[model samples]
Target: MPEGYEDVCAEQAVVEGGLLGVKVGGEPVVLSRVGGQIYAIGGICTHKPASLEEGTIEGGSVRCPRHGGCFDIRTGEAVRPPATRAVPTYEVKVEGGRVLVGRRAG
Candidate 1:
């Protein structure tokens, strides 16, 4: 999202229990390590731009802190009300302890 903001490391994606949320280009990005795979998605609630990182992460979904809206962390699909819009999801790739997020080039 920012200039020269690269992906995160595979190790950094996970510590011991779950994935890690990181900020890239001033935007919140959720990084999940599920089943040994890394997934990246928008970490902000679409309804009011609430930080999803501070919300609950369960069953591959992240809940909004502002409202009770739920979203699929992998697909960025809003699964509940109060958030009719879907957030942006990015493609994640792990290489040699490094994770890379794919974005549309300008």
Candidate 2:
């Protein structure tokens, strides 16, 4: 984990279509609750700087609002075209109503 950083309580209810964007380590991180687990990924779409928070959250994936690219929220894998590269994904854990994201392990 990065120094001087910790988990932040984003939301209690992670409905099927709920999405939350948070700033961590000076970077925008998108947190989506799917199947009762929190998945953290890069908030910005790889195809553009468009915020994923404004995108659609459905079928356990987030679609880029600017370009129509799709990505799996759990794995951060590109699921559709217009975005060939995959975004960064983080490990998330929930404790005491707080959502904690660990540093990307090497």
Candidate 3:
């Protein structure tokens, strides 16, 4: 575990197709529960200042409502137009019924 990054909340708090915005270690992150798996990505869209939490999630991707672009919730890949940069993806873990999000492990 990284210093200053700790458990945020329980897994059950995030429902399927749900979007949540949280800050861990001063970094804004958007957490999404897709099909039963949780994915964490940088909160804002690359092309605009819109929050990804306002977008819709389908399958493993999330679409930004502001610019109509999409990002792969898994790899953070910018899968659509207007977004050429991939958002950062954090490592997410569920332990003791809590969801812990943090930086990528080495």
Q: Sort by TM-score, best first: what order?
A: 3, 2, 1
lDDT of 1: 0.71
Worst 10-residue lDDT window for candidate 1 reads: 10-19
Better of 2 and 3 by TM-score: 3
Pairs of residues clashing in candidate 2: none
- What are the per-residue Cα lDDT tens digits for candidate 2 across 19-95? 78887677888888778777888889988789998888868889998999999997888899898778888877776
Off by over 4 Å in 2: 1-5, 10-13
Which prediction has the highest lDDT against the true structure?
A: 3
TM-score (C-alpha, index-matched) for candidate 3: 0.89
Per-candidate Cα lDDT values, in order, are 0.71, 0.78, 0.85
TM-score of each: 0.78, 0.86, 0.89
Scored against the true structure, residue 71 in model 3 reaches a CA lDDT of 94
Clashing pairs in 3: none
Task: State the weakest 10-residue window (summed lDDT) of model 2.
Answer: 1-10
